[model samples]
Target: MTFENSLAFAQEQDKLDPLAHYRQQFHHPVINGQQVLYFTGNSLGLQPKSARDYINSELDEWAKWGVEGHFHGKNPWVSYHEILTPASAELVGANESEVVCMNSLTTNLHLLFVSFYQPDGKRFKIISEAKMFPSDRYLLETQVRHHGFDPDEAIIEIAPREGEFLLREQDILAAIEEHKDELALVFFGGVNYFTGQLFDMKTLTEAAHKAGALAGFDLAHAAGNVPLHLHDWNVDFAAWCSYKYLNGSAGNVAGIFVHDRHGNNTDIKRFGGWWGHDKERRFLMENNFQPMTGAEGWQISNAPVMGMAILKASLDIFAEAGMPRLRKKSLKLTAYLEYIFNQVVAMFPDYQLQIITPTEPEKRGCQLSIKLIGSDKKFFEALTQAGVIADFREPDVIRLSPTPLYNSFEDVYRFGETLRNLLSQSHH
Candidate 1:
């Protein structure tokens, strides 16, 4: 498809978009009676229009039934998380029993590590990526230290080649091999937040297993944005938040996937809680802990109904528009965005912006991270003032993500026009 730097081209693409109606399903923020052009779905997705009714139903149930709402409601709170399980599994390409929605992402990270990061004897090392989201870095560091090993010695960080912004697949495979002897676990972010690079999880998991290490991923940026074959890929364990691509409420409930082999094993050590107890005997309250089978065994508490309601609304949308279909549109939309960005640079050589994200469609999601050559935040402020919602990373980077579910091709074109106009006027 030949690309053009014109609004007509974008509108034409939108006219042909199969998922174009999905834009109406979300509640984009309004500024001065007009909808802001949103591109932060990589950070927090716009709330689904259905979310209000979904949430209000729960609220009404709480008001009417009191404690009885747990067992009897439009959707029972007792098994609320289950409502999300099947679709969540389909989203990640996992078996139904291998996934569960529960605690926040960091909390689940800790719980998953407890079972998967059991270091013993000489195999006490962990390998991870450098510049991982700060929370993940802290989690790994603290977990390593908790096991009586120095973080510096126990955690090996794989970084990009000296001059590059993305990690090389070969370098990652070699790192697994290099640390094979002492490595107990391999952990990484599924899609890097800063560079928007999608690591090859399937290859990474295979390498980790070959090197005698367990593999895990924090899929905050990858979960709903990209296709995952967790079961087919034989990934050991993974976790992700709903707020970003999934569009659940902000800082909402998170979910996890444990391969059936691990999830079915009741012998694995875990920080158990009552909600994970065998449901049939849970009311009996036995002193002995009998865990449920599969990923349900990881639940620490009863589900958060409000957050799960929002998630349910969002997942229903995904179920209607399947991941495969979404991916099909995503590839074309993102390629078009990249093309327009290139056109901007071509039209104005003085703009001085470089796309730090990988050019391969297979290597990235919707996000394109731009490195501004100048240090000022004025450009970002200008974007905000003009009602374009993107993100700014400290000092140097800006991230623009055009979500396939709600963003149209015209949004991409307008973004280019906005930036080009702002820069041109500022220079004048």
Candidate 2:
């Protein structure tokens, strides 16, 4: 729909939103008793009201049972992370055995790399996106260095062409071809953290495999923001944190997915721990590691019960709402935000407002990366002071994500209005 009468359209759409009631489920931050227009779900999600109850239940268990809470708690702390696996697997489109909630994102990435990134002299290079998350870059560089390879020679960064904001699929394929002989692994963000550009996982994985390389994804920004099918797509492995779009608390549990095709490959090495041992013999404490089948074998430590409590609450909500239903509304909500941004851009022809996120719904998540012309840090500071809760990337990009579960149509409309007003008063 066009935006000539967007203000009226927004009001009407908000009235029709079936998921509108979900907004009240979150505890929105207040500024001077006014609710802010929050669009930073890409960073940290809004807190669920059930989070308090979910966490308090665990707290009560700890208080009452003391050390006995390990096995006697309400949710059974002995296998707390298992409670989240089915829901998380369903959300990411994986089989039950293929998924397991575990350590944080980067930690999982490193662990997965240890098994997937086996570099020989003939296949010693790794290809990744040019501007991955800072943590990911550090992990990759350190991993290469730890393997006695120079980061400069072992890492190949696929960059966008000059003046382009996002990488092209063809360019990525060509890079794989160019490095086929030496490339040991291919790693890319499922949805780029900065640009919100959703990579074509199936196509990328196909190319990586054809080039004799393993393909893995860092799904930190894509996990709950977009639909993924790791098994069908033949992705070797994937990792993601739960805090961002999943509505789990910050630094909460993360997850890993390993396709069942690799289940019998016993030669693949990993950093093992007792938690990953076979449940039948775990209590024996023989010091002999017998890794569990599938992704659960990747676990290195006992599950954090408190964090898993928060994740369970969030997943319960997701199971009730369903990702398919949530994604349908997410597309329309984000598209409406784009439509309004375009409307504002049309009003001031000289002002440049380039959306770095791909226009196609299939190529992006709910987040939109906006590049403002002739603006700086002060511009975003002004936006923050004005009660708009968007995030600013370094240099000159602002990202706004209207979360489907909690963000309403009115929130998108109000954000557009705030941006327009913020621009109107700017010195530029």
Candidate 3:
């Protein structure tokens, strides 16, 4: 697939794109009365146009039915989370029973750790990637502390060698084996938030199991951005937020995946609430906690209907487009963005434009983290002022993700043009 830098080529690609219609489904951000080129779907996805209606319907249900909405609304408030199960499972490639829409990502990770991260005797160490998302770092640090272990001694962070930007798969596997004797859990982000490197979860999961450890993932950037097979990968547990590529609103209700093997174990230790108890006996108000037989058993409370409604609106879109189709378009879109980046670099021979994201399509998702050598936040502000919305990581990386669902090839082309112009202005 040869890519051209011309607008005609981008428009033609958009015309031929199977997912082109989805672009109209979202409400793109506008600044100064013009729609901005959105490249931060990896950070926060565009809101689905239907999201308002989804929420309104729930509001209407509340207005009309009040407390009766629990039993009589269009989607019963009592089982609102259930409406998200099928589509959410399909998005991450898991059985409906194994996936549940529940609390936020970090909260769910903490809950999952309670069940999977039991450190005992010599098996108190955990292996993970260095410089993971701050929330996750905090979660791991506090979780390790909660177990009365020094985080420095108990957590083995697999870092990139020397000056490299990405972690080599072999290095990760080797680290797992190095600490095999004491490794109790192998945790990682499905996609590194900074580098956008997609780890080979299947191989990593296998390595962890062989090392007699459980493997889990924080899929905050991977869940909807990449096609995942958590169940097939034999992951012990995983969690993801819905606000990014999943297109749920900001800080929306998140999701979790517990492989059938773990989800089926009713005896697993976890914080429980009535919603997670045996549904048939929920109203009996029994003294004992009879946990449900699947991922729902990990729930700590009942549904947040409003957030779930917004998420459902987006999930329905995912169900319609499907993950395979989305991935197909995503590969081409990202490749085109990469090509544009190369073209920009070639045009600016004096400027150092280094792409830190992995070049291999299989090793990355839609994001391309650009390292602007010798540049600063001013450049990012300039980009924003020019109507391009992207994410900036401190030190020197700018992350741009051209999501397949709403972003077109034209968006990528325009962004390239804007970048070239910015470079030209900076040079002058």
TM-scores for all candidates: the values are 0.98, 0.97, 0.99
- Between candidates 1 and 3, the TM-score winner: 3
lDDT of 2 by residue, 17-120 (tens): 88878888888989867889899999999899999899999999999999888889677787888889999999898998999999899999999988998998
lDDT (C-alpha) at residue 368 in model 2: 96
Best-fitting candidate, measured by lDDT?
3
Candidate 2 collision pairs: none
Please give, for residues 222-310, the per-residue lDDT of candidate 1 as tens digits: 99999999999999999999999999989999999999999889889999998888989888978977889899998889999998999
* Runs in model 1 lying further than 4 Å from the true structure: none
Model 3, C-alpha of 365: deviation from truth (Å): 0.4
Q: What is the lDDT of candidate 1?
A: 0.92
Q: Please rank every candidate by lDDT, starting with the best.
A: 3, 1, 2
Q: Residue 140 of model 2: what lDDT?
A: 91
Q: Taking the tens digit of each residue's C-alpha lDDT, what string does model 3 give over 382-404? A: 99999999989988899999999
Error of 3 at 191 (Å): 0.5
